[model samples]
Target: MANPWHALEGVQVSDLGEKYFLFKFFKEVDIHRVIIGSPWTFKNHLLILHRIHENEDPLSIPLVLADWWVQIHYLPPGFIKESMALLFGNFIGKFLDYAMKNLSNGYKNFMHIQVQIDVRKPLKKKKKIMLSESNLRKI
Candidate 1:
């Protein structure tokens, strides 16, 4: 059986060095078939994917996926105030995993997902906060 995951080739990251990543999916035979996201697409897409899972909670759907990968870029301006890299990274990864499980067998939808973080300018001093498991208690 051929894998249905897509491969990304000739992919380019944004000039600003914004966090960018490539998600690849292959069929059982390992053939690349889709590439639908860029570093720029993460911000807009991340939240939507999150909600889908929240709304459908308690019921875990199994997505038949061949392979999935994410390339992350640094954060954008203003958004860099607080470092949520680790936090967001896991969030994004979880969402991608969920997405993989949700993709129906034989159904095609361009769902290459990415999460972008804002990186500060060079030679600049920024406040980096340490996020811990205890913080989740406050939420």
Candidate 2:
């Protein structure tokens, strides 16, 4: 995990037993960079991260939520508006933000949305929505 993170200085991972770990980073920037690159996994299991304060117990910190960037592809004609991203994002998970800046001007196949989801829950590959005009909205 540390190797893929590419921390500028270095990182130390402490095993806390029962699948929990305390990740210690030498550089503050490296830690922040790792956090910004959310939704990391190891051996197909989700690696949930929490920044605990000094003197806090690592095991006690909440670890139920994880942020993920979901790609919504081939949006229906009526569902392609920027404002609709919030609605679609919330439908998948807790809407965090719409990544409109990530999309190129020429790109039209999909949209990016950041959402916070429960790590315990299974992710859905496809979603269905209903539009007043179209009756069925699948993206």
Candidate 3:
């Protein structure tokens, strides 16, 4: 089905009808799923897949950072910037979790997940780059 997330403002869905599909439920197009079949190629940059299920047969929608950036860059002037950061961070975290749990396996190359946080007070120095390794070390 056509990517539900792609339907979001400013995000583009490639290969529609040719590879992707748009399914209707209850005559509403908003509640459909985006299914990426196997043998997919994640060109340059990270190939992010948001896992929707845990069963052997699951649906993974392909996402890219560039596309996300485009969406964020084109956001309406009235929208708060923090909202974009939060969405991007959440997407990054979810994508990283999925990759570490699923795609990182059976691979020789090592992968890393990085998260940025601004924990200091408003008058603080700057934001912090909290690597995922630090959390794992603590555990």
Best by TM-score: 2
Candidate 3 lands at a TM-score of 0.17
The sequence of per-residue lDDT tens digits that candidate 3 reaches over residues 20-124 is: 432323322333332222212334323334333446222344433221211223222232234435544454432212122123455323222223222231212
Candidate 2 stretches greater than 4 Å from native: 101-107, 132-139
**lDDT for each residue of candidate 1 in 24-136, tens digit (9 for 90 to 100):** 22232222122232212333542111112335532243221212344333333222212343344445433232221123575323223333323221222233545556754
What's the residue-level lDDT of 96 in candidate 2? Answer: 86
- Runs of candidate 1 exceeding 4 Å displacement: 1-30, 35-61, 64-84, 93-139
Output the worst ten-in-a-row residue range by lDDT, candidate 3: 93-102
Better of 1 and 3 by lDDT: 3
Give the C-alpha lDDT of model 3: 0.32
How many clashing residue pairs are found in candidate 1? 23
- Each candidate structure's TM-score, on Cα atoms with residue i matched to residue i, is 0.18, 0.80, 0.17
Assess each prediction's global lDDT (C-alpha) against the native: 0.30, 0.80, 0.32
Task: Compose the digit string of candidate 2's lDDT tens values, residues 65-88.
Answer: 999888888776556656678887
